[model samples]
Target: MPMPDMNLLIALDALLEEGSVVGAARRMHLSPAAMSRTLTRIREALGDPVLVRAGRGLVPTPRALALQAQVRSLVEQANEVFQARDEVDMSLLERRFNVRSNDVFFGAFGGQLVDTLRVHAPLSTLRFAPEGEGDDDALREGRIDLHVTSRRNFGPEIKVQLLFYTRFVALAREDHPIFDAPITPESFVRYDHVSVSRRGRAHGPIDLALEALGLSRRVALTTPNFHSAIFSTASSNLIVSLPETVLWGMRELGLRMRPFVIPLDFEPVQVVQAWHPRCDKDPAHRWLRQTVKQICATVEERNAGVWPQP
Candidate 1:
């Protein structure tokens, strides 16, 4: 017996992906007839007609359709493996990275992230994505490069690491009457509040703490993200709740972030960096994670008063 032509795998993979001789030709910059000949070779190797004519277009046969995703992933991983890091001059690495985070994330830490990256990778760009109801599908599909979030029970396949710990604080503008007087639960409850929760959550540690003492704040405005609450509180009298480590320089920008004692103590929030395990050993991906952590450290230093810097 003789060894098979393994080089045909690439062509087979392309043909399976495109399902059309013309499409594979366009992708590989070959004429349709040449691509057809290449497909004939692929069929000889695979022992199957991968792309069978179906109606006006070609469709993959049973074996080819089953092999589609696996082949694509394998070829992609192989390509990356061969394209190892050479002299990576950050200034020359031009790319747009998408990040999935909520309003509080961008308002609090995004500035530091941008500043840090710009000082080194000046050619890079950022796309801040919107937070939705549940798992970030963008991360799975490679649409998002980084995910800044708190620790939550996602599936085991997802990888995560702790970045920092943050504590909650209530925010009110400078010269707000609450700051001038005693902040009892009753006093706090009397004021209307602006708040955020991804699930449209009606309550939190603050609400629980207040309930323990038989009191509650009137949450006049409810939004899906911390950023939404921040912008709303900037001009209104509504009190905003936030994690101090993330919300930077808000007071100087005319939003006073102040500390208030909830009736009961609650745990400090843990800031985490999460990504698909597929990026585990990637050098550039690791570099991005480290850079983000460094920026978090710098921002945490400024928020030391709110919580002990981690």
Candidate 2:
């Protein structure tokens, strides 16, 4: 088989992303005719009419939409392979990095991560995006530099580093009557609870464990994040099943928690920092990973005794 022109991949990536041959031409500094010819070649090489006219605008076929992200990632990785930077030069590095994570992580370690980055990369800006709808697509498109989540099932190709493991615990106001004594499953199920998740998921691993034991709790309220759940607990008798790490800001967030005496042995939640494997050897991205890993280690160290001391 003859080697296809790799330049076509780069052009197709830009063309499909821009959705306009003229735009892609301007981006690549190529003439419209040259880019159109390149697009024709990409169509032949890929054996698809990748882009087509829709009214007055160019639109991608389903094939082009599917290939857009994959092609861009491949092009970016190929560029890195040919000119990969071996070392990070922080003093002169000026870049903006976007990290996708939940509010729990921001409340716990975003400050420390920002502090560390400020000291070294003076010109670097860090942005945090919440786990909104379609956020994973942002990561796939290279808009998000890093993603931190306890949720697994991110595709196998996403490069992942274990940051830490977190487990769910029951929480309420410090002076709540429940904390005066050992918390039994019966007692836990008696109290009203708050549901937490970006989608306001009313059930979780706790519910499953309870179901196994023929128990269930009343969900009094549903909120999107841990901060809201904890804050709500501070004013109401409503209990919350939250990750142990969210307790880190209890003194600051004004919430407290105690373990159930009839504790269910639930799966440990592994929090990981994930990125596209295309970023694995990129120096700037490597620095970002190390920086985040250090932040996670600091959080773990600072809250050492908080997790179930066993």
Candidate 3:
């Protein structure tokens, strides 16, 4: 038996990804004719028309669809094998990391994160992308290095690690009339409310908890992030419910906001950091992940004694 040409794997992976010979050629820096020849060889090796012409373009065959993820994984692993390093010297490392997270996280620990990275990887850059409301393919597509979120519906190939936990706490202006008395379900519902949801949702666990008690509070405002909701409380009678840890962050900003426990049983938010398995063995990526975990712990420790949390 003739030995199979392992180089065909790269062409096959590129063809399956682009769904067009020209696009694959451009990706591999080859001419269209050369890409076509490579594609023919790949078709013969795999015994499948990996991409078939359809409506002026090409679509993957069922076989190609099944092999897509596997092929990509193999290619990534092969590249890692060739590029593997024994150790990553942080002082000399120069790379940019893209992290996606909500504003609450940025407001609370963004400065510390940047400072820590500057000290460790002086030439490295940290870019923070805003969280999206819809299903995101950023991690799998390699658009972002890390996704810090409470969402757990990521594809099976994504690796996840718990960062920390937080629960909801209500915030109001320092001199709001609500501060005059002990907060209860009834008093908490007396004033209008502000909410933070990336999906523009006007209700959430807070509403369900209120409904359980036969009590309902009107959401007078809905902002797409916690920063807006937190700032809105500074000038209005509206109370905002946000992550408990964010209160300390607000205090550091010298915002005259008062924090009080919401009078309802609520689930703790299990914050997690997710990434693609492609970065699993990359030394620099591993160091970045460890740095994030360390930053979260520092934030958690600094927030202690500031609020009574469960």
Candidate 4:
């Protein structure tokens, strides 16, 4: 057997993308006659009428439709491979990045991130989606550009960088009864609590730690995000345990909330930003990762221990 013409793959991509002989020819800077001959070669090699005549326009066949995304990915990767590493012009970039994150992250750095992008990559658009919206392989399949989260359930091949480490702190109104006395394990469990779990799980390391001490707290409410839990604490006696970073600006946001050290042993949360390995070398994606990392570092440093220790 002989190797197939690799150039035909490019022609096939163009033809499928344009869906017209004249359009593909214009895109590739080729004559319509030459583009038609190339399409014929592509059809012969693939054994399919990749594009069929529809009344005044061309429509992709089922096979072409199925292969459209894969072919586009291949072409893009090939282009990235050949492009210069330092060739990215941020001002001219017109790409959209899909970032999946929880509310805690958005509360911490969303505004700063948007400002940085507007000044640097003005043509780029950042779409921040809530958690649990995409499939398991959303990052791998290129549906999501970045995952700024604490969860580490991604595949081993995914590139991950620790953005920062934050420990859990119980947040409540500054004048709540829990703060009237020393916050001990006994006093901590006396008040109702608000739990933040996307899965609606009310118990976690805090509960287990309390269990080990022969004590457990009642979770009166369970919310899916930290923002809701934080807000719920503002007007109620509910004590909510959240990452220290999430409550950084509670006072400035006019929430009148304060964080106290939980009287229990717990590990620090490793907030990380993850991406597919295919984007490891892509300049724009790399910039996004770096920008996020920088923003996290800046916020952590500026607001280090924003709330007073109780």
Which candidate ranks first by lDDT, i.e. highest? 4
Q: Each model's C-alpha lDDT?
A: 0.73, 0.82, 0.87, 0.88
Go through the candidates in order and give the clash count of each: 0, 0, 0, 0
**Residue-wise C-alpha lDDT for candidate 2, range 1-310, written one tens digit per residue:** 9987888888988898788999999999999999999988988888898999899999899988887877887887788777876897887888999998998899888888889888989889999988887556676789899999886778767888899887677777767778776777878888899999778679988889899999998998998887777778877888888777776766654345543333676797899998987778888889999988877886556666565464
CA lDDT, candidate 3, residue 258 = 78
Candidate 2, residue 290: CA error in Å? 1.6
- Native-referenced Cα lDDT, model 2: 0.82
- Listing every candidate in turn, what is its Cα RMSD in Å to the true structure after a full C-alpha superposition? 5.0, 3.7, 3.9, 4.9
**Which tens-of-lDDT digit does each residue in 1-310 have in candidate 4?**
9998888888998998788999999999999999999999999998999999999999999999888878877877888778748659999999898999998888888889999999999999989988884477778667789999988988998989999888898888978998788889999999999989988999999999999999999999999998888888899999999988777667678878778889999788899999988888888988999999989987567556586754
Specify the poorest-scoring 10-residue window by lDDT in model 1: 255-264
lDDT tens digits, residue span 1-310, model 1: 8986656677777787677788888888889999889889888877888888878998888988777756766676787788766446777778777778776677777877788678878998877886676555556545577788884665677788888887787776656788777777677777798768878776788887787788788889888767668777766778877787545655455545444544356788888878877666766677788887877776556775553233
Q: Write the per-residue lDDT of candidate 3 for residues 1-310, one digit (tens) a residue.
A: 9998878888888888788999999999999999999988888888998889899999999999888867887888889888898688988888999999988788777888899888989999999999876647788767789999888999998999999998888889989999898889999999999978878899999999999999999999988988878778898899999887677676567887778889999898999999998898788899889988988886566667566455
Q: What value does the lDDT take at residue 238 in candidate 1?
A: 84
The per-residue C-alpha lDDT of model 3 at residue 103 equals 81
Off by more than 4 A, model 2:
1-6, 29-49, 55-57, 132-141, 253-263, 304-310
Residue-level lDDT for 155 in candidate 1: 65
| Candidate 3 or 1, higher lDDT | 3
What is the alpha-carbon RMSD of candidate 3 to the true structure?
3.9
C-alpha TM-scores of all predictions: 0.74, 0.82, 0.80, 0.78
